[model samples]
Target chain A: GAGVSQSPSNKVTEKGKDVELRCDPISGHTALYWYRQSLGQGLEFLIYFQGNSAPDKSGLPSDRFSAERTGGSVSTLTIQRTQQEDSAVYLCASSPGINYGYTFGSGTRLTVV
Target chain B: SQELEQSPQSLIVQEGKNLTINCTSSKTLYGLYWYKQKYGEGLIFLMMLQKGGEEKSHEKITAKLDEKKQQSSLHITASQPSHAGIYLCGAVGSNYKLTFGKGTLLTVNP
Candidate 1:
């Protein structure tokens, strides 16, 4: 891809329903990250994946939030039994490696109504 | 606490004026990057700072990093209406995660 691409640019789901956001990072970047932007919480790191290493899930706020990168290319972020507080813009970014700046996707605006 | 803090939550300036936005970190930063986001658009990377006393500029924008103080600043020279947007600063944390500030919104009135 020419740049990082995210799917379902906007979403509105029931409070208890589940939602999945997808990200396709720039080809061969090797590193992918997930972040969330909310009204009052600002922007926060959600998770990160580096090559074949176990993802760093330390930033995931809860068990309801989980992400996985398959084939070291595309990634998906899943939120279960979504809460209103979970409503936010979910952003994905990719970089060549550590210490490198990121190329971010436009993001998926999830609104848990 | 937010590891990164951006000052002047929002600013309004006249066209052709100069303005600066600041980012501060409570802990030492290994690297600092600046980005701009327009309404409904993804962030656009502006510049990155890695060393103390390092400064970089692009066109009418300049960025400076004070590694010792864990701070960075972005200055727009002769601001234009096209420069209106939200400016954010991000850093690589000890754990290797990239964290960002809430952002500073700038509006240039033509």
Candidate 2:
């Protein structure tokens, strides 16, 4: 893809339901990141994937949040038993390498009611 | 935990005016990146600064990293309506993760 692509630009789900957000990073980008932005808040790091290495999950807010990158190209972020607090913009970014500026996708606005 | 603090939570300026936004970090930054985001849109990468005391400019936007590497500023000269958006500063930490400030919302009135 020419740039990072995210699916389901907007999602509204009932609380307790699970949701999956997808990200297709730029071709050959070795680094991928997931971030969540609540209303009027900063971008909060959720997870990071570098090549085939184990993902850095230190930023995940809780065990209910999990992500996986398949074949080092596409990634999926799944939020289990979503809560109202999970309503926010979920952003995905990719870079060629560490310390490089990232290209971010438009993001998925999740609303858990 | 690393934290980035941005000042002037929001600003409204008339077109042709100049404005500056600041971002301070609790810890030394290895990399600082500037991005612009419209409401409900993705972030647009503006610039990246790595070295202490380094400055970079693109068009009317200039970003500077202090020698201490703990703070950065983004200045927009002759602001235009197109510049209205949320300006964010992100810093890369030792863990290779990026942490961002809450952002400064700039409103350039034409």
* RMSD to true structure for each model, in Å: 1.6, 1.2
DockQ of each: 0.77, 0.89
Clashes per prediction? Answer: 0, 0
- The worst-scoring run of ten residues by lDDT in candidate 1 chain A lies at A51-60
Looking at model 2, the pairs that clash are none
User: How do the residues A1-113 of candidate 1 rate in per-residue lDDT, one tens digit apiece?
Assistant: 99999999999999999999999999999999998988655678888999746468888999999888899999999999999999889999999976788999999999998
Candidate 2 lDDT by residue in tens digits, B1-106: 7899999999999999999999999999999999999999999999999999999999999999999999999999999999999999998889888789999999
lDDT of each: 0.90, 0.94
Q: Is the docking of candidate 1 incorrect, acceptable, medium or high quality?
A: medium
* Isolated chain B TM-score per model: 0.96, 0.99
Q: Which candidate leads the pack in lDDT? A: 2
